[model samples]
Target: MLPSPFAFERPSTIAGAVRAVGKSGDGMFYSGGTELLLALKLRVIHTDRLIDIKGINGLDRIALNDANDIELGARCTHNKIANDPVIRAHVPALSSLCANVANIRIRSVGTIGGNLCFGEPHADPLTMLAALDARLVLIGPSGTRVVHADDFIRSELETVREPDELLTVIAFSRPTGPVTYRRFKHGERPSVNVAMAWSLGPSGRTIRSARVRVGALGSRPQPLKAIEDVLQGISVAEVRPAIEAVLPTALGELEVNEDRHGGAEYKRHLAGVLLLRNADEAIAAAGSA
Candidate 1:
């Protein structure tokens, strides 16, 4: 089905885009048009005005900040993030996740901001950003503000962003050690994916710090903080059971449903397996480095 009739506006400047959104109560910003267009066609989203930001200059570049953090432009595509040298070096887990998003065609046009903003529960980046403690930069008439990625999502498909605010960039401190990620998909499409990042600190032969993010298992990517807390000073081999033990409680409050992908029990089970495997892989990678 085709999208409902809507007025379109291409804003060449950030100010122009902000103004356009402010003018209409139900306006939606257009980036890669991958998810937004599909939502519109399905009548899931209705907007009188579509503000296109793709033509705006300088919003498509990817740069690493002085702090060694990545500053990903809101318009940066999945393909760009997946292949960017800076991203690969600083956050290899993120790069790996981006590379696995959908397929080549979708990644070519899907923007990072779009992916996060769409607020899909199963999307990979949300989990990665949360685990990395990434910050989102927003620009609006009231000026710019930085928000923690974990705090940005208020609920499913909801965020703190105001109507006039444009998500400009995402920034996060780079990981200090080798990182690895693993995801379990059913027949090529990812049913559940887990990402683990590891770094070594002053303590020798121990996990200095770790971040675990579980996707496709909750409304938002649920961080395995309980497991992380358990692993902080313990040997990597000793933490696997703790990781497994926390799953029932970690996901106790969440509502896991049976979808075309799998049953509730299956998702719950996969979440545990993926977490164990990812944590193990990340720990091995950190030790090897």
Candidate 2:
């Protein structure tokens, strides 16, 4: 299936892209055109215009600023992030996730902002961003406003971006402690990916902070905050029970429809298994560091 007829514009400036999208009201931004093109071909979305931002300068660069944060342009591709030295050194968790976001082909063309903005439940960026407490910079007619990763995605394919706003930059603080990230994938479908990141305190025995993000199990990425709360200040030996205690509660809220993979029960079980395995790996990584 081909996409519905749509007008295309290559906006040279951020303001221009914002104006175009604002005017069409039904326009979608295109970067790399990997996912959007596929969605369009499948008729998953209907739009009157395509505001291509590839022509816009400066949105494709990756930089680590004076604030010691990794700042990425909206158009930065997965491959760029995965291989960037700054990103690798500062936020290896994000780099690890990016490295695993499909094969090299998809990563070569998939934009960081495009992936996050699409809000796919199983996308790696959401989970990694949640762990890093990333911030999104949105530019609109009214100027720029920043939003945290946690508040950006309201639901599956739903975001808080205004019609006139374009996501320009994604920024996150550098990780101060040793970080470990792990994920489970169901074959190569790029769905039902579950990931968790863990960081230990100075004492090296207590869990200072942690993040648990489950994708492909629900309409939106689910963070296991209850489990995170339980892990805080606990010794590594006690983390397993904390993870187990919240597994059922976390899986209960997901909408795991039967797919080629398996049934809801199977997905729920996978989520628990992923939580345990990743949690252990993360703890181990921190302990060794």
The top-ranked prediction according to TM-score is 1
| Candidate 1 lDDT by residue in tens digits, 1-289 | 9989999999899999999986446788998888889999999988988999998998888887787887888899988998999888778777877888888878999999998888877677877787777899999888999999878877778888877789998887777654556677765446777766666666546778777777766566767777677777777666667677776776554457578778888887787777777777765775666
Query: Model 1: runs farther than 4 Å from truth?
Result: 186-189, 241-255
What's the residue-level lDDT of 263 in candidate 2?
80
Candidate 2: lDDT of 166? Answer: 91
Error of 2 at 35 (Å): 1.5
Clashes of each: 0, 0
Expressed as tens digits, the lDDT of each residue in 21-59 for candidate 2 is 865468878887778899999998888899999999999
Top candidate on lDDT is 1
Residue 235 local lDDT, model 2: 85
lDDT of each: 0.78, 0.78
Off by over 4 Å in 2: 245-258
